[model samples]
Target: MKVSEALSSRRSVRGFLDKPVDLDTLRRVLAFAARAPSGGNVQPWNIVVITGEPKQVLVNAVALKIATGEREFPEYTVYPEALPDPYRTRRFGVGELLYANLGIPRADKAGRLAWFTANFRFFNAPVGLFVHTPTYMGLPQWADLGIYLQSVMLMLREEGLDSCPQECWVTWPETVRRFVPIPDGHLLYTGMSIGYADPDEAANRTNAERAPVDETTTFLGF
Candidate 1:
C-alpha cells in the first residue's frame, strides 16, 4: 500500500477479530518499522511480543487486581494531572465520541469502567506487545519511541492488520513484569494490541476527528 494510504487507513483499533496475527508478518513489519529515525541512530526501543497462553495469563492477573480494588502508581504519568485546555478538551471529546458510539451514556460510569477493563484484554486482539526503554533514557529518546510506534502502526495498516498503542499497561508495571521478562532498570513505555479489526464491533466505529492543519501548524517562510 502507498504511504499516504497507510497513514489514512491506520486507526487505534479497539476491537479485533478472533484471528491470529502471523509471527512472520509481524517480524517483517517490525523490521521495516525499526528504520524509523532516532537521534544519532541510537534506537532506544525494546519490545516483547506476547500471545496465546502467556498473554491470557497477564490479562487474568490484571483482571483479578482490578476486581479486588487493587491499584499501582504508574511508573510515568500518562497525562498531566490538570491538563490545559484544547488538549484536554480534545482528549475528552474523543472519549465522548467512543462511548456514544458504543451506546453508553455519560451517566453510565460503571459501564464505562467495565468497558475500559477491555484494555487489559487487548480488546480481544490476538497479539500483544510491550515496549520499553532504559529508565535513564531522556525526553528525546522517549520522543523517538513515539515516532517508532507510529511507524509500526502505519506498517500494520499496510499489511492489512490493525493495532492499538495502549499506554494503559504502564499502570500495571509490576503485574506486567511478572509475566514479561523486561530487563531490570527498563521502563515499560507502553503496550500494543495487534490483529485484524473486528468489523462487527461497535467500538471500532469511533473515527476520531483531527484538528485542521492550520490549527496546529505554523509556516513563517511560506
Candidate 2:
C-alpha cells in the first residue's frame, strides 16, 4: 500500500476477526518497521509478540484481576489528572462517539466498564505485541519508541491488517512480567493488538476526530 493509504487506513481498531494473522506477514511488517529512525541509532525498543496459548494466558491473568474488582496503580500516569482544553475535549469526544456506536447510553456505567475488559482481551485479536525498553532510557528514547510503534501500525495497515496501540497494559505490569518473558532491565511500555478487523462490530465504527493542521501546527518558517 502507498504511505498515504496506510496512514489513512490506520485506526485504533476495537474488534478483530478470529482469523489468524499470517506469521510471515507480521515478520515482514516488523522488519521494515524497525527501520524507524532513532536518535544516534540508539534503537531502544524491545518487543515481545505472543499468540495462541501464551496470549490467552496473559489475557486470563489480567481479566482475573478485573473480575475481582481489583485495580492496579499504573506505573506511569496514562493521562494528566486534568487535561488541558483541546486534548481533553478530543478524548471525551472519541469516547462519546465509540459508546454511541456501541449503542451504549451515557447512563450505562456498568456496560461501559464491562466493555473495557476487552482491552486485556486484545479485542479478540489473535496477535499481541508488548513493547518495552530499558529502565534507564530517557524521554527522547521513549519518543523513539512511539515512532517505531506507529511505523509498525502503518506496516500492518500495508499488510491488510489492523492494530490498536494499547497503553492499558501499563496498568498490569506484574501480570505481564509473570507471563511474558523479559530481560532484567526492561520495562513494559505498551501493548498492541493486531489482526484482521471485524467489519461487523459496531465498536469498530468510531468516528475519531483530529485537529486541523492550522489549529495544531505553529509554522515558524514556512
Candidate 3:
C-alpha cells in the first residue's frame, strides 16, 4: 500500500479476529519500521513480541490483579491533572462519543471500567508487543521512540494488520517484566495488540475524531 493510504487507513484498532500473525510477517514490518529516524542515530527502543502461552500468562496475571484490587506502579498520566482549553475539550468530546456508541452513559463508571479492563485482554488479539526503553532516557529519545512506534503501526496497516497502541500495559509493568523476563533498567513504554480486524464488533468502530489541520498547524510561509 502507498504511504498515504497506510497513514489514512491506520487506526487504533480495539477489536481483532482470532487469527495468529506469523513471525516472518511481523519481522518484516518491524524491519521496515526500524528505518524511522532518531536524533544522532541513537535508536533507543526495545520490543518484546509475545504470542501463544506467554501472551496468555501476562494477560491472566494482570486480570487477576485487577480483580483483586492489587495495583502495581502507576503509569504516567495520559493527560494533565487539570487539562486546559481546546485540547482538553477535544479529549472529552472524543471520549464522550466513544462511550456513547458503546451505550455507556457519562455516569456509568462501572461500564467504563469494564471497557478499560479489556485492554488487559488485548481485545482478543493473538499478538501483543511490549515496547521498552532505558528509564533514564531524555524526552528527545522518548519522542524518537514514538516515531518508531508510529512507523510500526503504519507498516502493519499496510500489511493488512490492525493494531491498538496501549498505555494500559504500563499499569501492570512488573507483571509483564516478570513474564517476559526483561532485564532491569528498562521501563515498559507501551503495549500493542495486533491482528486482523474484527469487522463485526462495535468497539472496532470507535474512531476518535481529529482536529482539522488549520486548527492544529501554523503556516509560516506565504
User: Between prediction 1 and prediction 3, which has the larger TM-score?
Assistant: 1
Give lDDT: candidate 2, residue 148: 99
* Per-residue accuracy of model 1 over 11-83 as CA lDDT, tens digit each: 8899999998899999999999999999999999999999999999999999999999999989999999999
Residue 205, candidate 1: alpha-carbon lDDT? 92
Residue 180's lDDT within candidate 2 is 92
Per TM-score, what order, best first? 1, 2, 3
Model 3 regions lying over 4 Å from their true place: none
How many residue-pair clashes does candidate 2 contain? Answer: 0
Candidate 2 — which residues are off by over 4 angstroms? none
Best-fitting candidate, measured by lDDT?
1
Whole-structure CA lDDT of model 1: 0.95
Per-model TM against the reference: 0.99, 0.97, 0.96
In the range 144-203, model 2's lDDT, one tens digit per residue, is 999999999999998899999999999988889998987788888999999999999999
- Superposed on all Cα atoms, the candidates' RMSDs to the truth, in angstroms, are 0.6, 1.0, 1.2
